[model samples]
Target: MSLLPNTMRAVAATGSVPLDDERALADVDLPLPELRPRDVLVEVAAVSVNPVDVKTRMRRPADAPRIVLGYDAAGTVVGVGSEVTLFAPGDEVYHAGVITRQGTNAEFHAVDERLVGRKPANLSMAEAAAMPLTTITAWESLFDRFRLDASSGGTLLAVAAAGGVGSILTQLAATLTGVSVIGTASRPETRDWVRGMGAAHVVDHHGDLAAAVREIAPDGIDRVFTPSTAGRLPLYADVLRPFGEIVAIDEDPDMDARVLKSKSIAWLWESMFTRGVFETPDMIRQHELLDEASAMFEDGRLRSTLAREIAGIDAAGLREAHALVASGRSIGKVVLVR
Candidate 1:
């Protein structure tokens, strides 16, 4: 018998607002989500705020349903859909769910089994919650979108080194491949953090990105990865070697393909939700990647990028997290726990 209640409390967007304020997110009662085939009902133990959460809440229409805006979560499976085989009741898991579905801000969330992975045994729920969204973004950008081989032995310039995705990407590039990582961080603390994350060199993004990267790579970067690529695509084009790859995972509506024409740079975009949103045949790749990440964490090869932990899983805590993320100054990730 399931212990789930008919209703659960969720930190939800009451209305769209350009600024993060106390009223931005509120505690509301929502009916427990009904499961679809291959879905698992998770008893959410922890959730981490991402830039996507802040952006989605800020742009949501006021007339839309009260939106729950979390993407990354870790919890125990309380129930599973009929076709679910990867997990069962009582299995601990973590995932970054598709944006098309209800989010993980609620006390309970239903996620596709193919998008979920077993939680790393060595990390707590809060730590595991911090990894899903950022890790998936970084991993897919390097290995999938960029198609970087393990022994590529090239240089990579990662922009915004202290942010959620950049931190993990820097570490992954440094440890998992022969890539010489140059991470961009403007502030002193972020620069130090980037160095600690295994960047061979830390450059200030507020300065000339191309000049700074050239100082390190000299010839030019072999690859570039960034989460905030809007308006900065040309910087990558200027610094990247001819035929080098640039992978961006954020919304780049104004990005022009002409910028990379001269360099013959291959520009690619990686959205972590693409497979789940399209229900692609390779949707289970996310599961495989997270599972590999879990093993890496357990083996002490990778560390969770959880920087701060908020005490409660409520509206006030979520609002605080949103403000931190919106400020664009958070070191790693801000998590809320029950």
Candidate 2:
């Protein structure tokens, strides 16, 4: 293994401040992360900002230690823990690190081998960084939570299909399954982007969502994949078929799932962190799925959803990325590359 540095440059959230505040994120020097038995140390080449990062920043306690906030990353492995068997000193990899650990918005990050995958040969580090978290969320939602397969045929309504998770979910549904995808997009650019991701149809989600979806899928949706579920349950209940399933990635504490009971519809939540956070028996499934997805990416079956890229891994760039994501108007993913 190469001689690792004792300290590295990183950007951490100093406090729960608005994006406009200069103190929101700051550059600092931190000691290298200690590796556990299954950990692999990666020299982070690129890191992508997700909604979780923004939420975490906003909710950060003022008195707490500065928190490095990131999830999706693509990089080269420089060192491995004693028991790491999947990767070595020179593997190019990508992963969505667990929330419990220090994040990937740094010069180097240590992650579990089970949560990492060899980076796709066809993609740039920034492109690959755009995928891990969203890809895992979408993959688990479709195959794990909903249990949809290549043979399952039906109309799937993908809410906010222009967003990160929605973009990948639309592609996976269109490419890997027999389901016909009807993606929701509020803007012309987003609608076009969703169509490029292989959605069979695109509808505006701005107003009368159920009516717009009904125009494309009159019979009712067989499945629904949503990033946000707040105040949308009634709309879902109106559009979903009997016994249909809705898999969501976002949290909605006020969500009344009772509305779906009348239609016998199932509501499920997909948190990609579940396996890693709980140290589940099948945590390694993330690695397997990412490897499978890598092949798909190399073969042109799957594509990266990177829409914007910032040049450096610094506080300024991350704050800009955070602002873009928080605006809730950005399409696809925003990444910062070193």
Give the TM-score of each candidate: 0.96, 0.98
Clash tally for model 1: 0
Tens-digit lDDT string for candidate 1 (1-338): 26679999998785676444555788899999999999999999999999988778767776667788889999999999999999989999999999999999999999999999999999999999999989989988888887776777888888898999998998888878888888899999999999989999999889887787887878888888887788988788888889988887777788787989998998788889899999999999999999999999999889999999998889888888888998999999999999
Candidate 2 per-residue lDDT, tens place, 1-338, comes to 44878999999896677777878899999999999999999999999999999988788777778888899899999999999999998899999989999999999999999999999999999999999999999999999998989998989999889999999999999898999999989888998999999999988888888888888878888999988788888999999999999998888899888899988998888999999999999999999999999999999999999999999999999989998999999999999999
The numbered model that scores best in TM-score is 2
- In model 1, the Cα lDDT at residue 200 comes to 92
Q: Each model's C-alpha lDDT?
A: 0.89, 0.93
